[model samples]
Target: MRHLAFPLLFLAGCTRTADEPIDYDSLRAEACTSACAVIDTCDPDRFAGMDPEDCFERCSTLLPRLQEENQCGSREIIHLECLGKLTCDEFEQNEIGSDLSEPSSLDFDAPCVTELHWAVECDHKEPFNLDEPAPTAP
Candidate 1:
């Protein structure tokens, strides 16, 4: 995540300038931080036996992918940030990371659930397991 420190400390002399452009990457990173913090603290029962470090590490790798839209910069930063602000109760209610297929009560609209981006997927001979090492690409 790009730190605001660079612009604030070095360029702006510890103050922010109006003309400074917002870095979307940094915004996405901050969103991940907020989300991760909430999960690490607010959802103990949900994440039982999980290390907070693992959550931070996994979230760092995964959350940034939300910005990779088909159109250049089409995905808005606000929507991504909205997801970061999701409540622990809401997350628990959603039953994410589970195999359950019940329709969600949460509004996945522009203000919050603006859009769902599909991950890059492919047909593999074997299902990848986290317990085991990744299969070698052909």
Candidate 2:
């Protein structure tokens, strides 16, 4: 009984606590991976000479900028969320990233993406918050 209690307590202690901040490193990595997977499948020819690796790396390198945009209350969270939910089917139906000839032109179009055409840049900023619910105390 004593040994059982010890293992159970150790496992519980290893779990995340409510006060901990969100790990943006892991969060961004996952988001980038997801978005890149969709692009690799649906828009393989998005660039003139780019492959899946190039696209994934490109998405990864934008993490810092994404974090900054989110911190600035650009609602980047929605963009990241939309990217994760992006499907090849949606890409085909909506003609997203469909234009392979114009590499320099903006062709990305998705319904889930919000404020993508905001004429103005994000100005006001707010405290960084990922908006996830706080974990309940054990």
Candidate 3:
């Protein structure tokens, strides 16, 4: 996501000699910040081990509020919600890969959110079997 600090200062510091009255850039940045924060906290971990359909159902109920609050847009939230519904391996293979990275603010959108949601989701989903299958002794 575009950084906001510069734009925020530019907008808030409009001066008598300033040529630009309104800083759409800052406004957009603020909106993005709000959006990403909403996305970040909408942790798929909450629904770990849940059935896919159920996870989607729960996220569907909650995301509208995030949209209304200007935390995220309606367009892409569904994808993240859908991804949240997937199992860890399912999520990793289909939605993301292993080698997890800190999620970026840019992930508020569909594709990236889907990826990041699932990447983190896998970590929270469940641990793999550490023990080998027991051998059958004749």
Candidate 4:
């Protein structure tokens, strides 16, 4: 019985350590891909007449900045929020010179932006005291 108990405990300890370490580089690339997809879906008209290579180049330029600002290791929701804040002007300023002509319109009020703001402002509060029940409604 003692021998069996020791083996069982060792196996349990091994299982507890089985989760793989996060790969930040891969995560950053995935987040970048997701950000570009959101832009492509949400504002197709913006890229209508643009060259495919140019669009790819712009997105490539933005990916490193996004990775730097958002910390690719953070939760996916936070990454989405970072993406929501990204704008065409930001891309131009980072990639090209700030003196370039401005587009007539740029959308920064996507639904994800609102959700991100709400999460940051409201949902991220600390836990309640042990004696108090968490608020059921807000």
**Top TM-score model:** 2
Error at 8, model 1, angstroms: 24
Tens-digit per-residue lDDT, 4-58, candidate 3 = 1100011235344335353433333343443333333443354456454243344
Q: What does each candidate score in C-alpha RMSD?
A: 14.3, 15.0, 19.0, 18.3
Encode model 4's per-residue lDDT on 28-77: one tens digit a residue.
Answer: 45444555554554455555655553333455453333233232213332
- Among all candidates shown, the one with the greatest lDDT: 2
Residue 100 alpha-carbon offset, candidate 3, angstroms: 9.0
Tens-digit lDDT track of model 1 for 15-99: 3345765454564566456555655565544435545435545554544433443221223233234345556665443234221
**Ten-residue segment with the worst summed lDDT in candidate 2?**
1-10
Residue 32 of model 3, lDDT score: 40
Query: Global CA lDDT of candidate 4, please?
Result: 0.33
lDDT of each: 0.35, 0.41, 0.31, 0.33
Model 4 misplaced regions, further than 4 Å: 1-20, 47-57, 63-65, 69-77, 81-110, 114-138
Residue 11 Cα positional deviation in candidate 2, in Å, after optimal superposition: 22
Report the lDDT of model 3 for residue 50: 47
Model 3 earns a TM-score of: 0.23
- Candidate order by lDDT, decreasing, is 2, 1, 4, 3
